[model samples]
Target: MPVVLSLNVARKTIPVDYARAGATGIDKRPVDGPLRVSPTEAKGTAGSGVAGDSIGDWTVHGGEYQAVYGYAREDLDWWQSELDVPLSNGQFGENLTTQGIDHTTALVGEHWRIGSALLEVTGPRIPCRTFAEFLGQRGWVKRFTQQARPGAYFRVLEEGLIGPGDEISVVHRPGHDVTVELCFRALTTEAALLPRLLAAGDSVPPEVVELVHKRSVVELDS
Candidate 1:
């Protein structure tokens, strides 16, 4: 019985040295909500799926496939112990800080019903310079990539309201072994695993499938 520990939204952008925009909406704060969730108007042009959440970099951050970000509270707790830092909800720029779920192992295309909304897991959150800078950690991107606990990104399947304390139920799961952790590894550290991603079908992002095809050709030529 996974529950939304915190429903977070960034109401405004804040200055940051990492992003091209010179500002970021990664500094999310937990908000009282029954917030509406809907698909972005268009890819790379609109912001977040959550009504009030801001997206600083529209080009890479917000889109149909990455409308909402969910990170498990257990994973954040693990980071807190590893880094000896206090991490509050929304610390990692997640729209939903969840409890009682292991997002790292969640299968791509898995459907979660939260409140009245239905969200389908689309991909993993790739660690960026913005995320590293936000955490003020040295070699954070490489470290995060190596750890491979990248949280899940989701698309709004059925638009509705979501709020803190809402229970999250897995309503559907695609027939595949491609978990978020596997997808992250294939895209980042382990290129050898790219072939394995084929079984995931269209459940994975198109960019990932394209990369897999390109890499396969490169390997064959070599």
Candidate 2:
């Protein structure tokens, strides 16, 4: 059974001089006990958890579609070798550090029952300037994108409490065959995979479908 290895949240944003100057929510710390999870009420909405867990950039961070972010402990282990540094839970800015699950193979629209909350996989985490700044690695965005295992973003279907050690079980999986890794590849490295994304049908969010269509056009034109 997959389990929540750690529950993390950024109580407050940290200021940085890099592209993410004002404050970024990329810094997260593990915490014990149950933490509330809910969809962001509005852009820049904070305080969606029992603690002060909040999203820094409302324009692109927190929302109903990406209420929670999850990463695999296995991936962290792999990065630990590459970065030659001891990485801890939430080091990648994930709300849940999960164990015993292959996030890359996790399908979009798959439902996970964790604690009392129900979550649906929405898409893959696309590497961005904030993530690059957080990691502080040269060409981190491109490097991470090339890695092609961008974890998973989840939408909260049933708001509830979650905590470390909570068991996570798959309640449902959509018929779509598109996995999270495939989506990341389609979005980043391989334009040829864009048309294949539509095979997932409604399982893929409309916004992502739009991106896929745009990519498909560019792939054909190029």
Candidate 3:
């Protein structure tokens, strides 16, 4: 019944490292300042058009997904309020900013929209070293991740241009039994409890898939 919406999204001035290596075929142009640019630029293999796979567009995990990162309003407010900052200032490099939803409590496989782009909640972004760099704080990597609700990232099923000021709202919540919160709990408080959660066989990342495979009690496939 609640609607999840994106109020703001701040893409990294430096696109994800993988995106730059032509892995995602997204070119980088120093986001922010006069030279700020989006992550859609491709000047690599796709640039030559010789590669059969058209690597000039954003691809996730070698086409696993196009766009990979998102944030929710609740995460913003909690983090920002603690830091004493405004949510619109663009402190984080996360794209697909959000409003009206608490990503921490959101369920995996949930649906939402930003303009014409539809996104499904795939998983929580495992904090990378880059995220720490963005914060300009030592141990921020550990601190930020500890709070959970690291924000949602998705595999894009539809391709469309997304930018700031786009209104985001929820479309539906899948009837999956396992939820993102459970995954977060597994990753966080119940890290030692992973065997049980993975045994649940819910939505999770590929990296976790292997980890879960070993611990899964029942036959799990997804």
Which pairs of residues clash in candidate 1, taking residues 3 or more apart in a chain or in different chains?
A: none
Clashing pairs in 3: 5-99, 5-168, 6-98, 8-97, 13-31, 27-41, 60-65
Worst 10 residues of 3 by lDDT: 44-53
Candidate 2, 88-111: lDDT as tens digits: 999999999999998899888899
Candidate 2 residue 106 C-alpha distance from true site, Å: 0.4
After the best TM-score superposition of candidate 2, give how far the Cα of residue 109 lies from its true spot, in angstroms.
Answer: 0.5
What would the C-alpha RMSD of candidate 3 be, to one decimal place?
A: 7.8
lDDT of 1 by residue, 10-42 (tens): 999998777998999999999999899997654
Best by lDDT: 1
For model 1, give the 10-residue run with minimal summed lDDT: 39-48
| TM per candidate | 0.95, 0.89, 0.62
lDDT of 1: 0.90
- Each prediction's RMSD over C-alphas, in Å, is 1.3, 2.5, 7.8
Error of 3 at 183 (Å): 1.5
Candidate with more favorable, higher lDDT: 1 or 3: 1
